[model samples]
Target: MHTFSRADFERFGQLYDIEFRFPAIHGDNSTDDYIVARGEITEHSLASGFRFTFSSLEVLEAYDSVSCGHAPLLVLVVLDGIVRLTLGSVEHELTPGTAVSMQLHPDYPLQAHQPEQQHLEIMALAFDPRRAKLGHVSPSLHGLTILPRMPLRQWKVPHALQQLLRTYAGLTMTGTQKNLVLEGVALQLAGLGLGSEEQESPDVPVVPVQQRQRLELVRQHLEFTPDHDHSLKDLAQMAAMSPSGLRAKFRAMYGVPVFDYLRKCRLQLAKHYLEQGFSVEQCANKVGYTHATNFSTAFRREFGFSPRQRTVDQKK
Candidate 1:
């Protein structure tokens, strides 16, 4: 188990530009009482033109507390353990993988119940409704909107929200970059709450067996000679399918256009050579790029840094 001390919480809060406060408890308090593990208050601007906090609460016992009383809407995600939340008269049990959105009213109260030694990690995003202009968002997001006096629950986790959290917690992004990433996440969460579940299309035709076989053959061929300058028409002819048909089917199966995949393959080969200490010109030629300059441009776009810089960064 990972235990965070009070000093750890304080340092993290300072680094993230949030406030962390531990509530003072009276002597002889029971284990099952409302306690604040780390109180985070944030007002940082997001790239999407909003400001909010990424706060966590560690509940050691059963406790009731009112949160987001001043905010318009609050979003909660349970990262670990179980929590039973009572909003008004209704009760909701939130477990791992559960995302809930609740709108706050002045009189709304929340009660949290947990067993002894059981810990719950809760992340909250508090935002103002009037300033957020929730109603003005696209109609597709209407379902995600947590209206005042209403509580909403959804089953599946939003992909964008997950990505945002991953980036915020894992990546080394700073300043404008971090804000942009957070805004994107907020927008995605809003969209998921507002939009209807997208229906999968059943009418789209499946690729024929022969075409599928041909795509597999192409994949194998590329694996063998990834550095080759194979044109789309040539690949289509080899696959015995029209160029357009091959393009669409390849995208459907691989999630990237054929040419783009080829480019990635070439770049991967070049990166391997670079990591093995090959010079720019040698690596470029080995990866089918005629000029080192061209290889460098493509490499920077793909990896966000030059090959040499990557090697240097790795050394550090």
Candidate 2:
């Protein structure tokens, strides 16, 4: 494992305007194991805003960290342990098997509170739009300007993809081979996290302006009011389209099934409430779930963790 010292961490703090607090060591001379408890952090820089970091640290004591930077994009995957993070104005408790993606700015840096006595393994990829060329970027990101902030996106990481990331992080190869592997991994992560892709040869059909506007209206309703009991028939009527047409066209426009998107929004809201000290039952009611059991099942499927895992105690 790579070794780091207190001095090294201090330097890092200075560079990133980050503040880190942990248990102080007694002796003047301290070893890596004594300093980090266990595991290590491996970082690889690809470009101005493109960086990959794999961290597997056994935290010995509870610690807090806050950092501010101007990176445009960040993709984080939690392989183990819970990550309590507050990005800008929102807070989230990330458990194992969950992945989160966010657009970040210098104004609202990521604040993290890491609990001790458990091993934490995570992989993070940071990229800047101005510094790198991201071809065929997602439509939502096109003409992207640096905004004050943006909401985060969360999802469950597939088991296969999780293993692939772990393999790439632990590779011991050096030189050209290692660089090539890391670059590939970074691209794959960008595609999954940022919704970027390669240019397609087929030309996409032009959507009518009114039709597109109607679809957007439905989308905004789902995002802003996820607590409502939404059905395809009802949503289609709101959009002035038939149910089947709404289903096919909404997926074509947004790249996700309509109800699937609604479920994600509902669960995301539920997770936020859970972190804010709401009980699972309350969260279920707030998210339009009549049955807490059904809501819990969907929440687990969406985030890969039990709803109770995000309680305030677990958040610690």
What's the TM-score of every candidate structure? 0.43, 0.56
lDDT score, candidate 1, position 12: 56
Model 2 stretches with alpha carbons more than 4 Å out? 1-6, 23-36, 47-49, 129-150, 195-316
Q: Pick the candidate with the highest lDDT.
A: 2
Top TM-score model: 2
What TM-score does model 1 achieve against the real structure? 0.43
Worst 10 residues of 2 by lDDT: 142-151
**Residue pair clashes in candidate 1:** 141-194, 142-194, 143-193, 143-194, 144-193, 144-194
Model 1 Cα lDDT, one tens digit per residue, 1-316: 3344445544654653333333443355423233435333334554222455444444443334444244445566666567666553335677776777655444444455543234455556655534545344444334323342124444456555554553454567778777666666676665444335334246546666567657856754564477888988889988888999889887665556888877877887777777667877898898799988999999999988897786676567
Q: Which run of 10 residues does model 1 get worst, by summed lDDT?
A: 141-150
Q: How far is candidate 2 from the true structure (C-alpha RMSD, Å)?
A: 9.0
In model 1, the Cα lDDT at residue 269 comes to 73
